[model samples]
Target: MPAMTVNDAPVMFDMDPETPLLWALRDAANLTGTKYGCGVGDCGACMVLIDGEALRSCLVTIAEAEGRTITTIEGLSRDRSHPVQQALVAEQAIQCGFCTPGIVMAAASLLRRNPDPSEADIREAIPNLCRCGVYPRLIAAVQRAGRVTRRRETISAAPAPGIDPADAARAVPAMGPASGGEADGGTTEPED
Candidate 1:
């Protein structure tokens, strides 16, 4: 079977070509954020961006994804401060948090493709199962996060200086809106 690349991390799959990307990521690559929910692909738990489009990892075979660039929740950001992540935090949308990673990854990709996505677009992009029922807050956070990041990108590509301790102390996300509606966290997205 052909090999698959995940999050810029390369690995070989010594199984059949039909092996699902989800299994390859979890079993072979050992990256588990791509959860297995209704392996038929209706759930967004195992969603991963393949070559830019959000595709269910359960349905994509290693052979089909050979040499294609893939980004998982882990690859969404180097640290926990990623925009989408910060948005969730600011909105306090996490409950069980099991679905947070998947949701963030999906939303991050959506924002990347379309910096100014509509509320409906955000909803349509993240179809992941969230038993916590944080949809209302989640929607608000995602939209806010997208605006924040897009503003930064368009405003200035240069890196900003670190926040002073005094300012950090006052860095309460609620004091003011984040890049959009998310808070400013020290860390970015989660590690894959």
Candidate 2:
């Protein structure tokens, strides 16, 4: 039996030593989020996080994954609240849902490496083939996730409040629809 940590929990597998991690996860561990697409490393469908890096489970033998951290899409979040998952949902990036788990894992890995990935960066990082041709929406989702991650980082990195409460309340540029009128050289009448 091989002992390993799966989804932050310890798991022991009693399968063939040469069995791929994909079967060990789905069959023995009951973690089906890691799909088997081409049974080879060509497709990203079997992608999973191994020690925080995206790896194709099909190509990795049980011995290779022993004593290492393995995180499946199911372990990404309990409520499916991972940024990648949330962005995919918001963008309606799902088609048949068969490819979503792998895509989600791949996206997570990409975001971890580049929090503010550009469209090209996302395209380059994520090579997971989607049969439905949802590349545009997937790109949009990656962009949105990047924005959210940046916003959170900004908020968390803000300095402590100044001595004067008034100083912390400094005014910011108007961001409402009225601001657009100003940019377009249009005057708005004062409300009565």
Candidate 3:
């Protein structure tokens, strides 16, 4: 069994030591945010923060992760409030969303090390591939996130999670008797 602290929780994997951390997370731990792109590590889709460093979970085995701290996208923020996630949404840098998780993890790791990362630094640090070709916006988004992290700016583009029931009802039009619609068990249309 390999013991590791994941998302600030101590976890032990009851599987083969040689199993890749990606499988351990997705299959055993049910952390599916870490994706599986290129299993050989060329793709950054399996990226995760291992001890505050962006590492490919597919390339790192459970044995290598022993006693290490791991951070997945889910651990980054429960409400998508992380600067990286917010900036990504604000800049609309995500498409298809298959690669977004890995990109978020990579960007989060980069920002942690360099809160004021330059475009070049972001490029160098985040090798995650976005087939959506959001590279240009991604760079800008990272810069925006850096500013937010450094407290130089703020963004309210990312929606807050867990909407209140009342607010949700207000946003959505009433579909029942409240909207003047009949709530009776009888059919609305005339009988044939």
Best by lDDT: 3
Can you tell me which runs of candidate 1 are displaced by over 4 Å?
Answer: 152-192
What is the C-alpha lDDT profile of model 3 across 6-101, one tens digit per residue?
Answer: 999999999999999999999999999999988999889999999999999999999999999999998989889899999999999989999999
lDDT of 2 by residue, 1-192 (tens): 777899999988888878999999999988987888999787788899999998899999888899999999989886666777778777888898887888888889988999989888988878888888889999988877777767662112222223443433343224333443466787664447
Q: Rank the candidates by TM-score, best first.
A: 3, 2, 1
Point out where model 2 deviates above 4 Å. Answer: 152-192
Q: Which ten-residue region of model 3 has the weakest summed lDDT?
A: 173-182
Q: Among all windows of ten consecutive residues in candidate 2, which has the lowest summed lDDT?
A: 153-162
Superposed by TM-score, candidate 3 places the C-alpha of residue 119 at a distance from the truth, in angstroms, of 1.5
Index of the highest-TM-score prediction: 3
Question: Going through the candidates in order, what is the number of backbone clashes in each?
Answer: 11, 0, 0
Clashing pairs in 2: none
